[model samples]
Target: MDELSWFRVLNPNSKNPDGHARSYEIVNQNYANKTIAEFTPHISFTNYRACQEYATANLNAGCPGKSVLDYVEEDTLELTDPVAWVNVGFHHTDKDEDQSPMPIHWQKFQIVPRDFFAQKPTITEARSCVNGPTGGAVNSTTRPCIATNTELPTVSTDTEDPTTGTTLTATPGAWNEARTTWNYQYLWFRDGEPITSLDEEGNEVGATGETYVLTAADLGSDITVKVTASRTGYPSGTAESEAVAVSGGAEPEPEPEPEPEPGAVTSKVKASATKVKAGKKPTVTVTVNATGVTPTGKVTVTHKGKLVGSGKLKNGTVKFKLKAFSKKGKYQVAVSYGGSGKVLGSSKTITVKVKKK
Candidate 1:
């Protein structure tokens, strides 16, 4: 599951001399084929073009040779409800240590939410230092600067996700005194810095207006509006609104649960006593093991297809105090494991003879 951590982005892979460079593929699903060579680069019988960086246009329509950032800008992300087909894997080479009695190697990667929650999801009241503070009094009681004659402008947005080109509105507050020529000048900010964007002519200019439309540049940044209220008789009184986060991304889904593969099941059965009194029950233990997985599901003691008794498996085994044999004769009992998804069921049989009391 993707979640926000203190470390959101990874530093340059080459920053660490010992670290291997990580690769990413964000495209269509026809990228992989398992029938051929191991980690094969599919060239033949494929029309897909290799991806390149910072391309102005998609030269190859069959398979655009653009990097993920370019692909997101020009094609896949333009329309709403779009999907980015991302595939991740680590290909390793066999070393001397990877031979028989080899040391197991594991690789891990994370895909976390970019901007899904309003606040940090890990924050809680139990953690008093959530924002890095203790419940103690401070030496200086600092407060916001306010004036009786001047009121701060309230900033609001149609949507937090600035990627949609939503409108940002700054309503003028009640400025009672020195009302005449109370000119309001607006300047947008991103993380406390004046926000600048390029026009159609590609010129940098400050975003200044009572109502401004959010640009793609505003995405994944903290946005705020600073409004300066001025009049002929009074000095300019500037007040800024609270900053809002524009991390316009969706919540990530959790990984699916793991289950054992079929055709590797090994079932076994053991009885406390093969011969028991007619009225006494037989203690039957059923064990079902699989390669690389622990068996879990229903374990049953049966006669032919008829279930004698059913029990749940725990830690790959289950014990059943089966119904006592009535007649004085040798009989067969089958112990079965009702399998789970992708896991084939298995059964074992044992002999139990009933003796007269």
Candidate 2:
């Protein structure tokens, strides 16, 4: 629609250019036949009377010198699946003259599909890349939107040993780096349930910050934290860390052990005396240690691949008296530990000197 027409042209000095003086017109259009040009195009879109109520696909039925709208008659309500041609355009003010056909002038227009297909056509483009490629459907050019988790977030804790009365700090996973640009929230869970506790004034409340102190109520319960990440134009995303168990005034127990590995235990063997009289038993002390926890089981002393003495591990250590030696000489004694399900076995050797009696 041109606003500068001779009759209905609007005055830009008094009001904004073509300040929407008229409403748009919707003419009946159809797929069965071609749409004839309007008898006389108007700045205000007024001319034909037949289009007042209906349009026909038959171009042969139109009369000479009559607009397509004039040829069509109104009151045709039986027409199914009616098509509508909506008029849409804007007024472009003319600029200074240009003789050498300046670069193509730009105009605003859109021809988009609406509800023509079961699903949006752009979905095909997004589906092509969502799960990698399939049969060369890769879209190299710009595809429509594909919503997915762009940022990964995870819950982090301050201490590995979760014990009663220990303060635990958690850092919610990251979304956008700037906290002011987006929103983030934290929720603590106990055994899959939201954790709730009392405030200083004895009012009950839920955890909201990055730090939570363990209490007696948390004893022996699995604790986990969920971090929700949010940013403008992105769907909210949440991630949770593996659970951490709180102990009752004791160090938290280690998780179930994987298949045992070799050399998980270290052992030292010591003798009470380096030299002794023949037929005198020597005290052999063996100590075994596993990091951070006491190891249980037994230790055996062997001489020349033969069993000499064996004792059970008590507090990760044990002592055994070697049977008296009949001959006088230096004897190589070997101390070995039969490991437990949690740790591998260990072996070490010591020397014992015996003198003739």
Among these predictions, the greatest TM-score belongs to: 2
lDDT of 1 by residue, 186-209 (tens): 898765568887899999999999
Question: What is candidate 2's lDDT per residue for 115-197, written digit by digit as tens?
Answer: 23333346553343333233343232332122222333344455677777677666664443321234667787765567887
Model 1 misplaced regions, further than 4 Å: 1-150, 160-162, 178-181, 199-203, 249-357
Q: What is the C-alpha lDDT of each candidate?
A: 0.54, 0.53
Quantify how close model 2 is to the true structure by its C-alpha RMSD in Å: 22.1
Q: Clashing residue pairs, candidate 2?
A: none
The Cα RMSD of model 1 versus the native structure comes to 34.2
Displacement of the residue 161 alpha carbon in candidate 2, Å: 4.9
Report lDDT (Cα) of residue 153, candidate 1.
62
